[model samples]
Target: MSDFFEALPGAVGSPPQHYGNPLGEQKILVDGSAVVDLGHRGIVTVSGSDRLTWLDSLTSQSIAGLQPGDSGETLQLDINGRLEYAIRVVDDGDTAWLLVDADEAAGLLAWLSKMRFMLRVELADRSADFATIGSLGTPAIEAAAPNGVPLVWHDPWSSVVRGGHQYAQVAEHPGAEWSYSETLVAPSALAAASALPVAGTLALDALRIAAWRPRLATEADEKTIPHELDWLRSAVHLTKGCYRGQETVAKVHNLGHPPRRLVMLHIDGSDGVLPAPGDPVAVHDASDIADAAIGTVTSSALHYELGPIALAVIKRGTEHDAELAILSDGIRIAAAQEVIVPRDAGAEANVPRLPRLGAVRR
Candidate 1:
């Protein structure tokens, strides 16, 4: 977005892709002392004494208890609870700040304004007023967040949060130590990042996917629900008061199966090529033409440590040990499924048997 950024030394790439040395830069960026200009991200601010309650009533998180300097995430769904947008949020007493996709900023702002009604809330799309900077391991926004409140939304994906559930049966999440932060900065603050080793969306994405992070850019679909991407880890609070899509969420989580489930694919790197998003994912069969695609690749990246890896949403009925193949740019690449969301995702079948009568643990 800034020609100035392109001209910086080692800043040698375009937006929405890799910049600088990806792996080398990643080490620096994650150290918490460096910054990554999330220019592709947008910012919105909701200010007023009523901001917390108003937002809590509209989204899928329990945010009325959010205090100044507190941070979290929320989802905006349609009346039927289909996702419309995802937001990273923080409140600094005077303002409730939102970090969202830049492309959706205008629409989200307009929607929020129309919903104000008689509420004492003030809303503004502040993308023009501020830029976003991200860091992990330490606080890089101290120089920018004047209040020293951080205004940083710490990522809570690593642990099972209150009112949330985990679908990944792994004892420890690969991203368990993924302590990251994103904060608002003025254009002037971008100067701070220019001097540090730089990493871009591409680097961030590779690490994110490897950690099994469900990002809106890749994981969400038209009919996508929280259960599919295991997003309930942080974004949805089950015990929270009703919000749009809450009924659908509850119905599916408690009684129904998410038609599809997310998985990680360890793509064969023999060709040294990667599949693009939406590439057809078919059942792997060397003996015949691959059966009709059972799923599609949602995101793919060549991680420095894991090599070619991807995330896909396949039918929940797909065998957990199914061999998969991805058709990419005309070449068929082999893929092995690493279960992220179990096949029986929506059903919790571990109900223990009763001792004397048909009783169960509360």
Candidate 2:
């Protein structure tokens, strides 16, 4: 057994293991815990004289309300109010850090820079200078950390401070008992720090699916408005002033109902294989596929706790708990709807309606 697994009590006796493939010889030893190399997650540093004000004007969240030690979630949307990127912002005195999914960082940075030609804010890609790890449901191991590391307790999840400067983001799930912690560390000392069992991108995907957390470039589509993805409560500040996409955001929330809704998929064990992202999800009525395609699968994972699950965006009013099928590469996978929220409920009726824009689309 590896030292990392050995350090875990009782884990060495009967370590959880999973086969990478049904017919593959190699097996992945599950330690009941795993560390994800979040190197792919990128960080953006916004500093200079007007960092806070500048960011506040651009993002969907209220930046001025943030305190020195606090963190908040925000989204950057295009002029049409389509979500471009989602970020977790942490404030530390004069500088604020924006952490975003790895794939969307470059595009988001470029867009922000273009709008920052004369602004006092400076934007730099600090992804290469930092390391991040996400640990879930393993409080015992985190509680055993040495005192030297700066640890921040945000209720359900705690972050171990690594490197010279550290910042942590913690949040509790609204309807679930799960807790998540995201820790940012300086790249220089990351390799030497005590290792946590590493979880591959696959494991993280499964965890997110089970949690029903929506992500950008996947669960969120180019046609998706923030309200449709149910991101307003956490990602957007409705009270905040004008932004690139505020008008559309408000309109959708108030007057218009989002054409699509985020849904969870419970895949049947009898299916031959799980569908990948971008696969078309449809309703199977006896012998024929439904005429109207329901939605697209964004992320799919084999959950450690819930077997096979996926997060998808389906048309609103679709029947919950109804059996469906996901098709990809001539293979049909069986799926069922698991609604995250009912169609007509809290916050849906109160969203502000779009103001008249006089012939021109805002």
Q: List CA RMSD, all candidates.
A: 4.2, 8.7
lDDT of each residue in 1-362, candidate 2, tens digit only: 12333243333121222213311111121333544445557778787878888888988877766666567767888899998888787766666777787767787789889989787888889776656555554322332112233222221112211111111112443224335555665544444332544444565556556656677757876787776666764677766789999888777665666677877888986755877898888886634443446878888877666677888888777776678888767677788877764464223347576768686665
User: Lowest-scoring 10 consecutive residues by lDDT in candidate 1?
Assistant: 139-148
- Highest lDDT: give the candidate number: 1
Q: Score each candidate by Cα lDDT.
A: 0.80, 0.62
Candidate 2 worst ten-residue window by lDDT: 160-169
> Candidate 1: deviation at residue 97, Å?
0.4
Count of clashes, each model: 1, 3
lDDT of 1 by residue, 1-362 (tens): 35445676666555525465777656665665656667777888898889999999999888888887888888898876677888888888878888887888898999998899999999988887766766776553443464456567778777777888888889878878777777676667666655665577777777788888888867887888888898888888988898888998888887778888899999999998798899888789843323588889999988887889999988899898889999888789999999998977765545565587766647
Q: List pairs with backbone clashes in candidate 2.
A: 16-30, 35-197, 35-199
- Backbone steric clashes in candidate 2, count: 3
